[model samples]
Target: MTFENAVLKLVSGQINRVSQPATLRTEEKAVAGEAASQTPFSEEALFEYHLYTLENPATLKNNQAKQISLMSADSVPIEKKLIYDSSRNEINSIFHQFQSV
Candidate 1:
């Protein structure tokens, strides 16, 4: 199964399991209330959850660059240096896999 389908299946399965109880309720209102209280999941909400961003893109980039800089120290000077540079094309290539066809 695809990643999204797998995730939805896991989540929905959990919800389904939690929703059904072994003990039965006597009151009709109580049963109705319990059913009404259950949360309904939507595709939009699931997609948004997957796409949610915690930090600004610029801030994330800055933090990544800072982390890379922190890994290197002035005392540890080397003759040869290795750099990892990413271009727009590379970023697009990575992101393109998730885009809808």
Candidate 2:
């Protein structure tokens, strides 16, 4: 509560805030380097199927694709998003039962 203590706290917070970005960047680089060091091939290089699998030009279903579509925008590649055709359509009614919970 004293002015000296308050000023020291503020300075400490500011120093931490300034260094936080560098700390985060360093941590990210460290993890990436560690992961890279273990493997002769990265995901892009090792897994040709993951990198080069062809997707259908046409979107088959609207409702089921929503979550997959949104999450697909992120850098992480999802394997489950690649789906085959199915004619079933009870999801809206099935999903409605869980609304109260």
Candidate 3:
């Protein structure tokens, strides 16, 4: 192969890093389909999410995280100004940190 062809193959290979899919039994198919919706999250986030689940679990699990975030947005109540204050404080802290350096 020419140098260009070899370099092209190497770059293409790096783009496809996902592993092969697992072959599952018929019974496992249902469970895998049901569980596939869960996203990668920190352990703390998972624990907190499950804690909420214990009180009231979502009817459907096979959906994106946005579904859950939206569910929380509808269910959980908070003062908008309070949220704004915390966000402002965070931005100000970042700004000060940069200014100091």
Candidate 4:
């Protein structure tokens, strides 16, 4: 193509980029505005998130060490008990190090 045609094509691309209208619908724009205006998580939502973390095996096992039933049921789903035991020991040691500090 001619140099003039190449220049025109570049100019057209720039205009297209600059003049493109926003694509969000009115409802979507409102939702986007609301999300921008509010905190991502309220205190209640944060607390619930924390409660969820507490329900996981890592937390439950740490908190219920004295309970025989919990100890028995605390086994991971892995078929290899040796690997599980080694990893559990390592995790417990790391946990203890953190607790000590």
Candidate with maximal TM-score: 4
Residue-level lDDT of model 2, residues 1-101, one tens digit each, is: 11221111001123335454535355445545554444333233333232322122333343433211211112322233323334663332321111110
Error of 2 at 50 (Å): 17
RMSD of each: 23.6, 23.2, 20.9, 27.1
Relative to the unseen true structure, what is the C-alpha lDDT of residue 51 in candidate 1, on a scale of 0 to 100? Answer: 26
In model 1, what is the error at residue 63, expressed in angstroms? Answer: 40
Worst 10-residue stretch by lDDT in candidate 1?
92-101
lDDT of 2: 0.30
- lDDT by residue (1-101, candidate 4, tens digit) is 11221111001122345576769766556554554444222222332232111122222333344221211212223232222356455532221111100
lDDT of 1: 0.29
* Superior by TM-score: candidate 1 or candidate 2: 2
TM-scores for candidates 1 onward, in order: 0.15, 0.18, 0.18, 0.20
Q: Choose 1 or 4, whichever is better by TM-score.
A: 4
Give stretches of model 2 more than 4 Å off: 1-24, 40-101
lDDT of 3 by residue, 1-101 (tens): 11221111001122344797567766445444444434222122332232122222334324323233312112222233322356555533221111100
Backbone clash numbers for all candidates listed: 0, 0, 0, 0
Candidate 2 lDDT score at position 1: 18
lDDT of 2 at 78: 26
lDDT, residue 46, model 1: 56
